[model samples]
Target: MTAMGKVRGYNAGAMLLHWAIALAIILQIAGGFAMMHTQIIPDALRFTTFQWHKTIGLLVLALTLARIAWRLLNPPPAHAPMSRVESGLAHLVHFLFYLLMLAVPLAGWLVVSVSPTAIPTLLAMSPDLPWPHLPLPAAWKGEGVSDLAGTMHAVLAYSTLGLLVLHVAGAIKHSAIDREPSFSRMMPLGRLPRQSTAFLAVPLAAGLAVAFFGGGLAAGRLGPESTSLAVNAAPGESAPAATGASAWTIDKTASSIRYEVAFSGNPIGGTLGRWDAAIAFDPAKPTEGSAKVTVDAASIDVEDAFVKSNVPGPDGFDVAAHPTVTLSVDRFEAAANGFVGHGTMNVKDKIVPLYLPFIFTESDGRAHVTASVVLDRLVLGLGLQNDSTAQWLGKDVTVKLDLFATRAGAASPQS
Candidate 1:
């Protein structure tokens, strides 16, 4: 090693990494606490907060790995003079910080992976980062264990605060009591002696960083194929592979039916996995349009294990007896917002009036459609027998449809 006096400050790369990780950790701690065990923020807003928390936690994990790699190749400045006992304690605190930086996020990731709710962790809550859940087997997922894992994540995260206090106190002690350059050594702008180290020129550092990230993904793949996050279908039932004899052909590949409801004030979104639409409509003559949609009653997947288990029972859709739900529209009327389909929805045995508002656009032979329908689940007796008071599950649910279709003779989008 070079003489201790020769290197008086951390490399620029080390300083940048330190500050970045510190900021991310601080954000995660504050956001994580606000989302858990508190009524500080409204439950509705917590949904967005939960996503922000996850996104920052992942960032901390990434930066921590990078910091570890940087520390390995670039030597840090020497410690301030102190007794052997004091030096050991400082080193131990640092070691624990690094360990928790890795463990806390990993624990959080595990909590999401095994959670019973079907919520996804969209990086930045945007569609861009398409982060996938850690693949784990069915045996590792459920309500009981998910709650326990959540508790562990919270506990591990709170421990970071204790370590932060000790770490800061040590820096202050070195600067104030010992009158040393402990804090200045890591500052970006200071009169401290700067060390010249090949920060990124080292191939070993890059290799270790890659290993750290790739190793985690590889471990997830080793487990059995992850259970479907949101999926529901009855035996022998499946989504149509191609357009049928309807006036328009639905491109199942280019379409989706998603539903959202507020559960305990937090939004729970899901999908109807097995459904098909038959359209006999002409955009040129809006008033002469007609359509019908059939949805497998058992395909109500909200991603809640308890909800899924009971959703097809006597108190819910009663799939064995009802088998399917249908929406039929006899005519469409021109509306300011595009068009409206005055329809009726049949759930089990009840027939309730419904109005679907949607916008439609056609180019060449393909037609694009997007519609939103808000229905009161209570009126239709969905989960009414079990949750009559609208206690856990909210009363109204919004179903969104986005699909692309082609005139019957035109080329199929799926084809």
Candidate 2:
């Protein structure tokens, strides 16, 4: 067949692939922006959105590759008559669109691969269906590499948007203004009425406006907020004095430290199976009390054996490297219900200021103290960054302690 006859229009397979990939890309863009921009999304919803976005991105990458292979094997239809420069510009735009479709998803994949948070990309939450791991250079296994890849992903995605606008505008112009057959070439059912094309353009423009402006507004309103609290002294600095306090011995059998956080939209509780504390306090003189506590990071137990074992690994606690977490409080201020202590916490090689509020009751030389505090996991370098992974695993961790103590050289407190 002659070139014009052979290339009269895209084959059935080409047209099917075109619409399939186009629809997937549109959904991916919408989901990506919505998930990234919206603040305070319920954890489960946010996780589901991210999973869909990642899955769709992978699908787009696969479909684009297949489309390219098909296009190369079977040449596209001959272009409608136009100026040489116009044709060249159209070809250049088409080429860039394809290039960006490939680049954008690969960049996104790289961002997920090197993320310090280390969330796995599982297909439909099935461990057996995870995306193939992409090997990283030794230097690329850090936040810096992830940040660079994230930037590239954003840039390429915007570039793809720009090219899409141009491509769509050219098609609309050819169909509605110039009254040409250009737009019909790839249409499975051939040319539509000019009125139908105009109707389609109206909704297309509205969708674009919503995606751009609505997304920007959501991001501005819902993005992460500053949660920094004031600290009296920097980490490792001298703490206030707590003298004139009687030393107390902690009753190991009755003392416990527990933490609670939201996981998969449910409240999950855990405990530090092994920990110790040294306390010196006098209920009569609250300001003269001090306490030091140490936690064995490897002993974190969340009820699930698999999760329990993994929590101590590099991506979670890195307990092998930083085996212990410690907190020392030497200053206390009386509160309406209890006393508040100012201190510093050392974990994962990062020291951060900590505040503890507790209620203390004493009877017959024995004391029972109940304390609680909320810590921003990120500040302590607890392997949770401000990325999607961190969002899935909530930011604030609530630590609660119950201690039974007695004056030094005294017997254990009677129940």
Highest TM-score against the true fold, candidate: 1
| Cα lDDT computed for each candidate against the true fold | 0.75, 0.68
Displacement of residue 10 (Cα, Å) in model 2 is: 1.7
Please provide, for model 2 over 1-415, each residue's C-alpha lDDT reduced to its tens digit, 9 standing for 90 to 100.
1123233566665677779888888777767777777765665787767766877787677667767666665657675566687788899998997898889888998897787655556545443344533566757867898899988988888777788898898878766765666667778775332211223433343454345334433442333210111111212222232233488877778888889876656567888777767776766676887878877776666642213324666656777677777888878878899888888898877888888889988888888899889888767666454343564565678998988888777787553
| Candidate 1 per-residue C-alpha lDDT over 1-415 given as tens digits, one digit per residue, 9 for 90 to 100 | 2233543888888888789888888888887877776789786676677777887888788778778878877766676677798889999988999999999988888887787654445567653333456767778876777788888888888898999999899889888777766777888877767877874734565565566556644443342222232333555333333343437888888899998987757778888778888887776686777888889887867754335545666667888788888888888888898889988999989999989989998887888999998999989988775566776678889999998889887887568
The positional error of residue 13 in candidate 1, measured at the CA in angstroms, is 1.1
Each model's backbone clash number: 0, 0
lDDT value for model 2: 0.68
Q: Give candidate 2's error at residue 158 in angstroms.
A: 1.1
Clash pairs detected, candidate 1: none
